[model samples]
Target: MQIIVVSRHLKSARTITIMPRHVLGALAVFFVLVFLSSAFFSFISLHFRLPIVENILLSVQQQETRQTRDYITNNLNLMATRLGELQGRLLQLDTLGDRVSDLAGIKPKAADVAEKPGQGGPFLPAPLSATELQQEIERLATAVDRQADDLAFMEFKLLEKRVEERLMPTTLPVKNAVFGSGFGYRNDPFAGLRSRHDGLDFAAPTGTPVVAAADGVVLTASYHQEFGNMIDVDHGDGLVSRYAHLSAMDVVESQIVRRGDKIGAVGTTGRSTGPHLHFEVRMLGVPQNPATFLKRGEDFARLQRR
Candidate 1:
């Protein structure tokens, strides 16, 4: 580039040439001035508390603060909903525990009664803060744990009851047999005089199946002179059952037997005059009324039916 200057007092014209370097230098100086001016104005604005700049900065900060508050509120709301669901599940566990306790016939302990309080009211909606919600969730979780423990205890008790029932003499020895003389003082069929009958009699056809009344180990299966072919089963807890005048013996001594297992057949092998079963129950080697145990069995069966 070129520039010419005309002068009349000196009677000469001056010509100036512009190169690429000169153009570059001018651009650099212009940028430097612009940068310094920007810096100066920014410093002045901050030092003098300019309303326009301050307002812009304050607006940006307020927007960020609002966004943060909204995020926290949304998270807390979701957490509250989850806590409510957990509480509902805890209530269901409590109800289940109650049912199991009833089925197992478990009486509530003092601790259980104290833990559960009667609580009922009209629904009142209220918003909870984060801290309160957390505390409530913790309390509900503890309740759920307690309910689980209670249910486990009930289950154990139920199992124990079932085992005891199985071990007890609950089944009738002879099915569909005619009842003869019962346990008590009665006229002796052989002596023709009043005597105490230590057992009950069930008259049945010869070779009629005679089953065990309970679960036990056969202690004796041998022929006796007066009782004829007899079998004694030793149930646990010092209880024993005797079956007299058996026609055929199906079980052996020291053999385990379950309730209703066929142990022999009915017959009149002893001092009796007709085919019948002499069933006796004894505790600690002492005679007991067989009717009492049979009645208990009947009551248990009736309850099961109900």
Candidate 2:
């Protein structure tokens, strides 16, 4: 390619030669630079201004954050509810265990069974942080585990105690009976001399039912000259209860009987007394104090004194 230049001030016309490849190369370079500059500026503007794309991205991120928070909150609430239920069950177990211990005459070791968890005063408390809540939950879980162990041990002990109590003489032999002759030294009406009374005499009407003191098997249910119609129950561990001076016997030898079951009816057939029941609690053939085994209820205590 050839280029011609005319200079009117110089009054001269000149002709210069140019290469086609060189001109094309220069045009290609210019276009390349323009494309690069345009791309750089477009990237800068997109980064600074972002438009609706930025809002869309932010919305997606916010949704994800909200979902994460809700998931955490829901799980925390579930855990809290479960923990509350466990605590309630633990409290119930404690109450039942205490009652059983009372019946067994066993004292409780820990006094904190009635105490509640840690509590804040009237001041408003701040919400626990994540770490704090987790720590507290773990602590509560450990406490629940410990309580479970204790309750299991207590339940086992209570069951053993129940078995033992059933085989021991511990209740009244006659219902609504007044005290007649007490245990120990007293004047014998028949002999007219000071004699020893080995059992308590409960005066009742004729044919008043006499119940067994504890769950046991009848050892002797026969008539004797000194006892009239009588029944003796052999509780386990060398313990026995005697219901003597009866008008009629309801149990036979070797018959199983529970506490409060009718064994006979009261009578004065034995030695001359009013219609009465001669109740005796014996261990190894030796008489024991009936007051020592009777319950400590208010009415029973009054009856015991009477």
Candidate 3:
């Protein structure tokens, strides 16, 4: 294309020719330069690890990495703390187990039976290369085993003592009566002279029912001159009890009787008395204080409830 230009200030006129190839080539080169510059900067940023630039960029990356590491460490620490708590719980369980075993009368060796879970299977042994925490848990388990044995023994002894006490004649042989005469020597009611009284006398109306004071088997249920209509019960554990001066007998020889069971009636059959039941409690053929065995109100009441 041709173009004419006129400059009025200089009064000049000129003809100019325009070329499109050079203009197009220049515009393309300019665009290429912009693209190359951007690509170059990006490459330097990625590959050429320049210390100052890299450090600034790495600061943010390092902060993120540090936060991640700290979070992992905190989690690990929390886990360790929880594991320690579990170990402590295991120790407590061991101690409790020992106490229970002791009360059960089971031998330490026999504890193997209970050592395993009740659901199924034999005992599980800890591995040789166990962790320190696991070893501590095992130690606690062993301690519990020993304590269990002790508890079992204690329980057995307590039960035995309770049985023995129950078998003792430690309450009123017959209900609702006062001690007319206590054990030991007092003026004989018949002769008015000092004589040893082997038993105690409870003053009650004649024909009142008498009951056995403890569990025993009747050894004698026949009449005697001094004892009148008498019943002698032999309580085990080397003890014997005698009920004398009775109106009638309710049990026979070789018959077993429990505490509070009817044995006979009270009467003035043998010696001179208005009417009374002669009750005797003896240990190994020697007379003991019947008053000690004669529990009064509420104390014996508690026993009967049991």
Top lDDT hit: 1
Q: What local distance difference test score does each model get?
A: 0.88, 0.81, 0.76
> Which regions of candidate 2 deviate over 4 angstroms?
1-141, 157-170, 270-274, 295-306
Predicted candidate 2 versus true structure: per-residue lDDT over 250-283, tens digit per residue: 9999999998898889998767567888888899
Better of 2 and 3 by lDDT: 2
The lowest-lDDT stretch of 10 consecutive residues in candidate 2 is: 296-305
Task: Give the root-mean-square deviation of each candidate in angstroms.
Answer: 9.8, 14.0, 17.2
Point out where model 1 deviates above 4 Å.
Answer: 1-82, 107-124, 298-306
lDDT of each residue in 1-306, candidate 3, tens digit only: 788988877577899877898789989999999999999987897798778778877998999999999996776566556556766765676566556556654455664546664586789986332255556555666655665565666677768866766677875766666557777899987789999988878777887889888788998999899888899888788788899999999999999999889999888887656688888878888888776776632444432220
Candidate that beats the other on lDDT, 1 or 2, i.e. the better one: 1
Compose the digit string of candidate 1's lDDT tens values, residues 1-306. 999989787588888999999999999999999999999999999999999989988999999999999998998988888798888888898788878888898777776678666899999999788888888888888878878887887888999888878777877888878788889998887788999999988888999999999999999999988788999999888899999999999999999999999999999897888999999999999999888888776532332110
Residue 108 of candidate 3: its Cα lDDT?
54
User: Candidate 3, residue 191: CA error in Å?
Assistant: 1.5
Candidate 3 residue runs with Cα over 4 Å from true position: 1-129, 296-306
TM-score between candidate 2 and the true structure: 0.55
Q: What is the alpha-carbon lDDT of model 3 when measured against the actual structure?
A: 0.76
Model 1 residue 78 lDDT score: 81
